[model samples]
Structure formats: C-alpha cells, structure tokens
Target: MTHDSTGLRRLLLVVADGVRHDVLADEMDAGRTPALAALRARGSFHAVTSSFPSGTGPAYVPFLMGRHPARVGLPGLRWYDRARSLSWAPAQARSYAGIDIWHVDGDVHADVPTLLDLARPSLAGMSMLGRGAKHGRIGRSVAWMLRAAPSHFRGDLLGWRRVEQQATGAFLSRFAAVRPKVSVLAITSPDKFAHAYGSDSAPVRAAIGDLDAAVAQAQAIAVRDGWRDALHVWVVGDHGHAPVSQHDDLHGWLEAEGLRVLAHPRLHVRDPDVALMVGGNAMAHLYLSPGERTRRWWPTHAARWGATLDALLARPSVDLVATASSATTVEVRHATRGAAVVQRRESPTGPRWSYLTTTGDPLELGDSLHDLDAGTAWEATSATPYPDALVQLSWLATAPRAGDLIVSASPDWDLRARFEPVSHVSTHGALLRPQMLVPLLVDLPVTRPPHRTADVVPSALDLLGISCTTDFDGRSFLRGTPVSAAG
Candidate 1:
C-alpha cells in the first residue's frame, strides 16, 4: 500500500486567512519581517481581489479550485441549502473537526477538480475540500489539544493558535519525509485574532508577527528538506478584514418593514412565507419560500422583490444590492454609488460586459461606455467600487443557489440577523475594497499580473510545467510574453 514519493519539487501554498494586505505590507516595510522582505525582493507581489462576499469559505474556492465559488453555489459563511432542505453555518462550526457544510462529498459535488486533486499525494491542513490530512492524525491532535489545554481549547484565541501551529507543523514534518507534489498550510491565527480583536488591534498585530515567523519556518523546512530552490512558496491571504462600527439588524429592519422572515426549518415541503438566510456577517442572501418559487408567480413577485430591494438600499447601513436583471445581466444599486446596470456581451477580444450609469455616483469611477471600446469595456469592468466588481457580481446574480437577492453591508457596518451573532470587531464578507483586496506574493515574475484569488493556482500550475486542458475561470499569468489586451 506504499506510494512513491514525488521528491521535493512541489508547490507549498500558505494561506494566511483574513490577513489584510496593508497590515502585512506595513509590517514588511517596517523591517519587522526579514523573511517576507526577502521573498518580496526575489519575487513579485500583487494586490489581487478576493472572491465576492469575501468570506473565507467562498474565498478558499478560488485558491483551491481556480474558479468563482458562485459556480458551485457556495453561499458565504452561512446559508440555507434548498437542495438539502437544511441550513448551514460554515464559519462557526461547533467542533474543531469542522462539519461538512456542503453536507456532500467534496470530489463528487465540486464543480471542478480542486488544486489538491491536480497534484496528488498532497497534504492539506484545516481544509474542508479535496483530501486534507488523514483523519486519524487530526483526531488525535484535537484530542491531545483538548486535554492539554481544556480551558483554552474551545474559545480561547491564543490556545487555538498554538494548537493550530502545532498540528500544521506536525503534519508538515511528517509529510516532508514523503515529499508530496503539493502542500497547503492554512494559518488561521491572523483570522481568529482579527475576528476576536479588531484587525488593527495590538493582539492582531502581534499575531501577524507570529504569522511572519510561521512563513519563515515553512521556508526553512523546505530548504532543509532540499526543496529550497525546487519549492515554489506562495504566501497569500484568503481575504482582508475591515473594521466595523455597528452590526445592522438587517432582518429586524425587514420585519419592521412588514416582511415575514422564515428563519426556522420547515418540517414539511410546503412553503409558509418569506425566508431570510443571512450568513457571512457582512452580507445577506434572501430566498423565497417553496410555494412562492413557481415561475407563474415570479413576474408579479419580481416587482415586490424590487420594492424590497429598493427599501433595503435606502437604509443608511446598507452598502450595495444586486439582483438578476436577465440571464446575462444584473442591476447593482449602491447606497452612495447609486444605481447601474451591467450586461454581458461578446466582443472581438473575448466575452465582456458593459455598464450604464442611471443615477448617483457610478459605483465605478471611470466612464466605461467611452466609444463602446472593447478594451475600455474590459478595463471598466476591472476599475470598480471593488476589484472585479462586474464579473463577480454577475456570477453571483446568475448563480441558482445565490439568494433571489444579495445585499452587502457598508464598510462601517455588518448585516446581523437574530441567529448569526456578530462577535468580530473587524470582519470581511462584504463588497468593500478592504475586504475584497488581498496580497499575492510569488518568487517569479508573472507575465500577466493576477487579479483575483482564482488566478493563483493557474499561475502556480504554469510554474510546475503542468498543462491544463479545462477552461479555468482564472487564466494563467505566468507566461513569458507580455499580456495582450484580452488578458
């Protein structure tokens, strides 16, 4: 039953969950991290956009699958699964062994093969998809951690951080002997610390320092194992965190507006009333009841839905609201940016979309409709209130599982329902630029700079000399030649 080792030529992807690009950059500039500074000097760095909703689970999709999480109907932090007739809360898993939020087999259920699948005999730490570390080891580690630090095991941030480092380090140490083709270590400290304390808090800053050392530790191990030059290390963040001034009672506001929120699970299949499935702290995904889902009723319902959306947008805390305008188009109404419509169209270069400003600030800064230029159109799509705003919003609009309407909170606010508590002082999962933009660091010059989390794996694959036949949502940016207008 023994398998051959892949030697040391492998990709080591280090996911620093919820670490802000600015925080790390500031620390690196201050000469606090020689390791990161060394990597930056030898490599390239990019401030790429994270996934829409900017939640860890959705953000992980791009890093792991090189595609939008919407393609797989991955509703952020928490959501109700219509297919399963059940609700899920991914970010707040009750046990150390995070539950299968999808409640389905990863390989069979996923839309595309994860990066873990592409590179076999891989080692993953604290990942829900693909093949993570063996259960026996993880279980034993969890048990040992609980017994050793009983008070700190469950909710204590410092305790959890130490245990996570131990578990990941142990796993990596064991896997080093086997030398898998790919290895991923998800450092959850910055994320946990930022959530418990504000992203800019002293504790979070100290945790960032610790994370820098962890990255150095990984690099040192790779070097000692004879994979220093052979190993391609990527120190990246899943999503950036933003400070929140208030947690808006989005559900409460809806109820005050006379909308009945069906928050509980139904015993039978028949629909009762309106449903509000608010997961991902800074966002809300609204779903219709079973009875109201009929096509015949949709035409009339759309108007009512539009009214509701308008009301939500009118709120001071609400940032943006998007709903399907058509099969290939969506209308986004921002609190300050006003309303705009984006339509998917084909150009000579490739598939692109255009925007038209109807009212207020165009959410997007530039005039994309100038001469109807295709390049301009593409560029306009990129220059937005948030990175890749048009495409990400479009995908979410078209996703069948994405609520009938998706709403985001302003930078200073979070969308909190009765069930989903807002404990974090700083949080992601919003359309704001702070949450969406994450740093991408690599040791080689990327011919075409990456723009989103999805682009990471493709760039790595190109470095590994692996040819991908499937049309990935993310294109490789590691080519030697200069990128064309299309890229």
Candidate 2:
C-alpha cells in the first residue's frame, strides 16, 4: 500500500448486495454497524435508485459501465443475444449450483468501457452466487477461502460468513498490497440469505452485522496499512429485495393458455404457435419464433400480439406490460390498473421524452401528456417508483432481439419460468420501490444529489481525477466535472 504522489490514486468500493437503503439505515441507527455509521458521517449518504428490471445484472451493469444495460448491450439477467446465438438464463448456470464461473453471453464487454477497464490496473469483481469472475487474482480468493477454512470445516460451508471473510481478504489485498486505482469488493450474503429467508428475517440482519464487522476490518486495514487518506471508499447496494408473498407461474399460465413457452430462442421453428421467453423472476419476454408465423402471417396478424398482451394483462399476478411501438416510443399497459404511452423526442437542450396517459392509474407516468426534461427524468421515475422505466424498457421493446411483448409482475408475486426449481422468498426485478431503492454512500464531496446507480461510476472517475471517454447515460454528481465519451 506504499505509493508515491505520481502513481495512480486508489479507491476502495464495497457493494453490499441486496441490502436495502431503509434496512441499512435501520441497522446503522440500531448501532449494529458502528463502523459503517462512522464512515457515513465522514461522507455523503443518499438513497440511490437501481436500474430498471432492478435485478443484479441491470444494477451491476450501470455501476460498472456508467450506462444503462440496454444501451451497454446488456439487456437483463436473462436475454437472448441474436448476434452471439446465446441466451443468458439461470438454467445455463443451474449446473454450477448458483455459481457461474465462466462468462455468459450477458457477460461480454459493453459499448462503453467499465470501471474495471477504464481504471487500469484495477482489481475488481467477486465469485459467488453466479457473479462471474471478471478480474482480480485467484490467489487472493484462495487465500480468503483458506483463512476461513476453520469456519467452513466446522459448519456453514457456503454461508454468508464465508463470503464476508473472502470480502475482507479482497479488500486487504487490493487496498493494502496491490493498491489499484479502483478496487471493487462485493459482499453477496444479504442478497443470498434474503432470497432463502425473507428480506426482513433475523438471518438477514445477522448477515448485515457480519458485513459491518467486515467493513470495520477493511477500513482499519486501509487506514493502518493501506492508502489511508488517499483511499476514497464508496459503499452501495446493487438492488433492494422485497418479500414475495406469492409465486406466479407465468410460463405455466402461458402454456396453459395454449402458447408455446420456449425457454430460449430457437434458430428454426416450424410451428405457428406463439412462444414466451422468460427473463428474471418478475419479467418475461414474449415473441413469435422464426417461422411462418413470424415471417408471413405475423405482419397481417397484429391481433395475435394484442391478444397476447391482453391475456398477460388479464393475469392476476401481472402488474404492467409494455412494448415498443417505434424506435423512440413505448406503450405501457396495466390491466385495469392503468396505461400510458411514452416517446423519446428531440429538445433544444438535448434528447428528452413526452408522456401521455390513455386510461387507468397512469402506472407512474402521471395523468397528462407533456414533455419531460432529460436531466429530470431519473427523478420522475424515482417519484413513480419506476427508475428509468420508460427509456430502458423502450430500448428493449424496440431492440432487434427484443421480444414482441414485455411484462412486469406484481410486487407481491414473482414471475418465474415453468422449469424453475422454486421461487425465492425475497426477490427483485421490478420497477417497484422496494426493489429500485438502494444505498449510495461515498467519502468524497459530491456536487449533486446522487439519484441513480450509474452516477457512482462518473463520481468514481471524478474521485480519480480522470476524464471519461465514453457516452454514459449517467452524469457525475460531482459539480463542474464532465465525463467524455468516444463515438
């Protein structure tokens, strides 16, 4: 951790997976995390919103690439990439028992480079709960495992405690020894435990306590042996989790309703049946396969798409259904709940959007048709509890590989594929607040109020005194600093 004034500065970023802002606040207030509380006092703490779909992939993509998943070429946790002939899904990683060590189609490099790439010589990523090993030396991971061998041997072989230990080691190695410009340490216990046992369970709280202890250790190492005052630390949650009181077999329902449910995109299909390509626990991508139905009959048979959307909206478990009408327009409908149409429009300042409501609750876009400012769009979505909901979904709905129909499940229920083993007790992947709201705390003096997860990256670049060379959907919260982008 010894360095001269000429080398790259170091930053220690800790991502506490699945821990909600409110939950973290409660923990800090209860004095369960004294060290974390102290850190917050020395810095800024704001409730940041996660990306739309609100799943790990979408959330992580923003933080890493400083862009929305759709813009970065990563759509969701599960999506079919036609160019690569690959599909990102849990079934692909099921054999690993929630550990996907290898990169999948969704794990490709983005159009905009990530913090890992931009911050050269950076040590980033963690391996556990299917998070691919992007970078960082395997030796440190092994050392952490060895250090926690006694606890793993005694009991809790694959528990959050082990994850905390590994995180501690990762922080120590990166901040104290390697001293990279940007070191990302992810603690994935709260998310995993919350899925097994509800988000508000005692076990989840205990996991937070363990994370707090780990944070304490990491901070002590940074101050005692690492970069000390030079190290800028930011702690955040990928996405929040909500208790799922009910499980919806959207795939089963589609099958029972006489629709074919193909888990992934099939290169060739002879049948005329409509199919469903499911994504996360709360969203499904419905599309007609490449066949006579898609090629010839589909153009004249617009009713098929309408009927499918209608049927999906009729489902008691569904909350919202959306699709792209054009390159810049999206229509979002909720059964009897509400409906709205949003379109991207050119503005004197920049590219903005217009929103109009047809009927029902408005779902979040409000009750009138009006133009919206690009800079204030995130705040609008946050107010609606639909973080970047309009733009991101619009990209997916109109994408070349996008499904004909896109659906979001109700908060109380989680949408799942027919073949999934079981539904989680606590889950994410929706526009609702419980899943969208996350914690963002940084030691640096930010210029603006942080609102979105993608803001973290530009802020990081600001902290490193580096200029961004990519077009990021997110802007820096730090004032006067501009992040550049390569066309």
Candidate 3:
C-alpha cells in the first residue's frame, strides 16, 4: 500500500434518514442545531439526489456502492424472483432449493463494489460501525477485515450515539498513536428519529440536534489530535421522508367490494382488520379474490364491474384504479410479460386519481408507470419517464388469489386501517425532489469545499491521492493531493 508523509485524512459520514433540507433549515433558523449550523457555515451544503424507489435500502446501497439500483439490480426492497421461485424482502431471506439467490431474479443483483474492498488496499486501517440490525452484514464484514489485519481495522457494533462516540474516540486515539493514512466514521441517528416521528416533528428536531453535537465532538477531536489539516468530514442522508396517513381497515374496503381476505398465518399483518398489505409511505399492494359472486358473473359483467371499481376509486381516499384484465393474471408494467393475461385499460381520473387501469394482483405492482398518471403533482413524478402508480382499493376485489386489496392513504392522511402499518409522514424514494434531493456537508480539517454525495467516493480516493479505476455515478469535489502514512 502507498503511504503519504503529509499525515492521514479522516472522513466521517452521518446518515440521518427521512430528514428534509427544509426542516433542517427551519431548525437551524430556530437555533435548535448549533453544531449543524456551524458545519454549514464552514462548509458547502446542497441537496443531492438519492436513488430511485427512494427507500432506505435502495438509497444506502447506492450511497455506499456509488451505482444506481437498476445497475445494481435492486429495484425495490421486496422483489419476486421468478427463476428461483422466491421473494426477497429487506433483512429477510427466502430459500429456493437448488437455485442461486442472484439467478432468481435479474433485479436481485448488487452492481457496485462496496467500500469495504476498495478501502482495504489503501488505508493503514479501516472500520465500519452500524447502528441498526439491518446493517449486521456490514458490521460483521468490517470486523472480519479488522481481525485479519489488526493494524488496519477498528469498529464497534453499537447504537447511533455510542457508535459515533466510540468511532470518534478511536480515530483520536489512533491518530495520536500510529497516525494511520485514512479513517472513516459513520453516524446513524437522524434517520432513526425521522422514522419514529414525522420529519417536522419535535423528535426529529431533537435528533438533528443530537447529530450536530456528535459532529461537533468529532470536529473537536480532529483539532485536538492535530489531524485537522488533513481531515475531511462529510454529512449526508440516504433518503428523505414524506408524510402518510395510516389505515387500519384496509381489508374492510376490499371485503365490501366482494373479495375474500386471507392471512399469511406466520407473518401477521400489523393491521388485521382493514389492511392486507402495506408499504412504508403511501404505496400499498393489495390482493384480491374472485369470490363466488364476482367469479360467476365476472366474465359476463367484467366491463361494468370495472366501471364500478373505477367509480369507487374516484372517492377522496381512493387513488388510482387497475382492474384485472382476466382471470389468473395481473400486469405490473407494460413490458411485464409471463402472466397469462394482463391489465390493459388506462385512464386519468383527476389530479388525485391520475393513473387507471385493469392490472394484476395488487401485491405485484412494480415501478414502471409514472405517479402523475395517478393525479399527484410532485415534481419527481411529473418529470420522470417512469412514475410510481398508486393502486386503488376496489381493484383488489377482482383478483382471484388476492388476500385483500391493499390501499394507500394520501401523503398526510393516515389510513385508519393497518396491515403492517408503516407511519412515516415524510416519504422519499420516488424520483421526487423531496425524496431524491439530499444534503452533503464537508467539515474536514482540510480546506476542501463541500460537495454532494455523488462526490463521496472520489473525495475519499482524493484523500488517498489515488485515481479511481471504477466509473462512478457521482464525481469527487475535494481538491488536494493525498497524504500517505506508513504503518
């Protein structure tokens, strides 16, 4: 490994999930966050775009790998893999006998190489501290690397605040002793607060304040340790949030439309009375069954039945409509082949009811259509070629195998029904501005200007004075020659 004689440069990444820039600005104006305010004043700050589907899993994957979900093949958190006859959900594993997980679905792939391997060849030591159970794999991998080369690893699998403290302490202790060439510290508290409370809620503000304190601590350590001249600190978020209402009786509406609702027996739905299925934000996937009455008359009155469904969906709470084109099939996207039949009709109801069609089982909706087609005026939906579709409740009544139609409430309206109710008021993941745009602030010892998340990887590489061999979705904004240190 190459070493720099100038001293080591340190990097800190703090991921605050579901925090919006506007909310941060408001808090800063209110004087609730002096630490973040100081960083903003000393460094460059702007909202950088997150990945498609704007959820945590998708956003973090790209933030670490520097690649798009499509390129990495992880389009969303849950995906049905046809080849392996299995479905994949975040932090859950489903086995398909005699089939490789990657081969099951083309979309189940991870495209970019993680920082774990990239940082290995350059740094004197490296460590990764993860706050959530969902990041167990990352923590374990970092531990393994450290075990292999004791001189090159340091990390703790602790909660957000503790992890930040330990990581900052470790960097100070190490810099004072060996003065390693590079180090990274990541904090994950802001995201947790946003998920538990709405973005604008008091709890979120407090979380941001806590994160600011942690950053200030890290900055102090940098100065005291005399590494401030070469250090770089980066604050970024994986994705922002959107407000959504919770529904308790999602299945009740489906039952009213003449559909039988079933349960998974093992995985209990959070809201059993009304909800069949739920997504974090307003997006939901509902299952429908062609009950005795609907099935018997389905072929004869399919058109009229669809019209009735369209009318019911036209209600205030209801959004888009997609009816089944025929028995035994639902179409999630236009090119979504393999089904025996597909939903064909397309209509625009209004700004509220934008996209309408007779499609497939509610649970299988994909990200092919635009959200504006369903009546939303969000810039992310309006500008993108592919807008997310919101499924109507009545459409779930027509599926032969559907458990119940999944329904999504409006942005600020909670569905009073619950089938695994997810209550994040501010959602991001659609190519929308609120979800896609995130802030990147630099507070390193070096005089490098702050930049966006897209510049993260290159910035790290720049600290090491090495040109990246891989092509990145973003660029490096840090300007300076890298300093190397010998172990």
Candidate 4:
C-alpha cells in the first residue's frame, strides 16, 4: 500500500450483505441499532445505489476495488465469455451461486486490484471474495456439500443464529491477529434471513438487530485495545433485498421454447444455443447463439428479433428485455410498456448518456429524450422505480463480458423458479430500488455524498492516508481529499 504522509492506526470495513437501506434506517430510527446509529450521528449516512446485478460477489467489488463489476468484466452472479476458445467455450460459463464461489478471484479482469491487494498483510473474514488477503481461506469441501444439501439439513446444520455469532467472533479474532491497516468482514446472516424468511418478516428484523450487537462488540474491542480514536470503521450494506412471493424458471422456459440452455450442473446439455444465467433470482442473462446474439448486438433488435421478442415479452412477470444495440447504445423493450434506447456520446468533459424513447418508455424514465452526465443521470433516476437505470444499464450493456440480452423480472417475481429444493421469500439482483439501494456508513465527514457503493474503497483509502496506485470508477467522497488521490 502507498501511504500518504499521515496515516491512521487502522481501518475496519464491515459488510452486512443484503441488508436493506430501509430496514437499517427503521432500525436505527427506533434505536435498535445503537452502534451504527451512533456512527451515523457522528459521520454521514447515505442511501446509495449499488451497481446492477446487485448480488453478493459482484456487489462487493465496489467496496473493495472502487469500481463497478462490469469494469472488471464481472457482471455478477452469472455470465459467460463469448470470446473463449472453442475447447474452453463449453467451460466459459461462470456462476458464483455455489461452490464455484471459489473462482471469483481468478475470474475478474487481471489488471484490477482488490482492497487486500493494495493493503497487504491484511486478513479477510466471512467472505468468498478475499482474493488478496494474506490469511484468507475457504473450505471447498463444505461449500460443495452446502450447494446440494437439502433445506432441512441446511437449516439444522447452518442456522442463522450460529452463523452470525461465529461471524462476530471471527471478526474479533482476525482483527486482533493481523492488526491490519485495512481489512474487511462480511456478515452472512442478513442476506441469509432475507432468503429464508421474507424481508418484511420478524426474522429479518432480528437479523439486523443481531448486526447491531455485532457492531457494538466491534466498537468495544477497538476501545479496549486502546485504538478507538485511531480506527476508521465503515459499516455498510452491499445490496438491498425485496420480498419475493413467486418464481419463474427462465432456463426451463427457454428450453420449452425449443432452444437449448446451458446452466450449472447441466453443462452437458450439448450444443446449447442459449445460456440462461440467473442472478439473485430476479434478473437473467440470455446469451444467444451466433445468429441471434452475435458479437455486435443487433443494431435494431426490434426488427431482427421479429416475433421472438414478442414471445419472450409475453411471458408472465417479464419486466424488461434489453440488448446492446451498439457499443454506445442499449435497446430496451417491454411487453406492455414500450421501447427506448440508451446511448453514450463523448462530451468535451467526458462521456455523456442520453435516453431516447421511440414509443412508450420501457423504463418509464420519461416521454421525451434527455441527455445527462453520470451525476445528473443519477440525480434524475435515483428515486425512480428503476433507480439509476440510465447510467447503470448503459455501462452494463457495454461491459466487456456482459450477456447478449439482459432480462429483469417484474415486481414480486424472480427468475430461478425451479431446481432449488427451497424457495426464497425475498431476493435481489434486478435494477429495482429495493435491489439497488443500500445503506452506507462512514465515520468521516464527507465533502459530498458518494452516491455509488464503488466510492467506499476510495473513501477508505483517503481516510487511511494512502494513495491508490490504480484509477477507480469510485472516488473519495470525504472532505479534504483532492481529485487526483484515487489514482
């Protein structure tokens, strides 16, 4: 790590995965989470939008690497490489949903650096993406079993109570063991509860309550170690969750459409013409065969897709069907809504985005065309049903490893409708507000709000008095930091 002249004693980054901003806010307001509430009172709290495909592994990228997953060719939970060699093409499909989680470190773009890489001699706990942590490790055998274990067996073996308690204990031990200048701890219970029980259920509330206790324990440890004042702690959520009452087997639906589908555990489904990789059970990547998907996305999918688009759109709960029409453009379609295109143009300052709708707005962004930069685009759409869709979708469609067609489910619906032994009550991964909005907690007094989770890394670096050796999409939102510090 390249440190600035003045450095802090240490830094602690705590990630409570899948904890919703609204849930946190309500808990904090009601005084159930005293530790985080205290931190917010002394610092700043922002309900920021996380990047698209807001699942576990990929969403963590912003906090650790200060960049969107797409920036590193990681489009979250599932995706495949179109450029893979023929021999490796059949093996190119990637899924972080299970035991394959161990491959995350190797899958990202080679040039990108994780937080552990920049901050060496560090330790990571309760995490799957601890690529650079010196002492990080995972039990592959246990993970593999968990992937196929029955719900009842999993319930008895890995209950939320034990998982969270162990997580807190692990955080304390790892922090003491390494005394790292920078580190991270990801709690698994919040996300777990949301999946097992609905997000609005009592169990979910109790999970956040347990998180509050964990935060308290961390603070107590810091103070007891006489490093409270010297420690810069950040408690944040990677992504939020929404209540899911239903499911749709998009993979099976594709197969029923007379198209072959490639999915995990079923990789031998020979000559697969379409790869249906679902993430967070709410969004899916429909990778098409050469004639349909192609290298350059169809210039006008509305014309090229013919009745296929209509058939896909006609599916129940099918919210949005989007494809990259060009390098700088994204064509969006809906069953009953309408059509629109997101285009990027080089501005004098930098790249600018425009929302062009030929008919009814697919995203319902507006009726007329509008052009805006990243900030303004965020401002205009942050509170909409599809938060920050213009900025997020434009970059997502153009991401080097993105799927041919991005499909999002309607409210209360998720894509992974079959194969799972247990059904999820609540989930994420779509561009909806519940999935995109996450609570951010930082101890520093910010000069401005860093509306994106990607800003967490840069902000932490700024507080640690270190200079990032690489450029990042996320910049420090803290006060007294210069623009060039991110690099």
Model 4 quality (TM-score): 0.89
TM-score for each of the candidates = 0.84, 0.83, 0.55, 0.89
Query: Which 10-residue window of candidate 1 scores lowest in summed lDDT?
Result: 89-98
Cα lDDT tens digits for candidate 1, 211-303: 677668777786687666566677778888888768888667766876566543222323434556554478777765534332222234575
- Model 1: residues >4 Å from true position, as ranges? 1-8, 85-111, 131-154, 264-272, 290-300, 335-337, 346-350, 359-362, 366-378, 381-384, 417-422, 481-487
Q: For model 3, what is the C-alpha lDDT against the true structure?
A: 0.43
Q: Which candidate leads the pack in TM-score?
A: 4
| Candidate 2 local lDDT, residue 89 | 41
Model 3 agreement with the true structure over 375-463: per-residue lDDT tens digits? 23223233343222232221232333222222334335433344332334454433334555666665433333332344576666666
Residue pairs with colliding backbones in model 2 are: 469-485, 470-484, 470-485
What are the root-mean-square deviations of the candidates from the true structure over C-alphas?
Answer: 5.5, 5.6, 11.8, 4.0
The digit string of per-residue lDDT tens for model 2 on 218-240 reads 66776786456566667888888
lDDT of each: 0.65, 0.64, 0.43, 0.75
Indicate which candidate wins on lDDT.
4
Candidate 2 matches the true fold with a TM-score of 0.83
Model 2 lDDT, full chain set: 0.64
Worst 10 residues of 4 by lDDT: 144-153
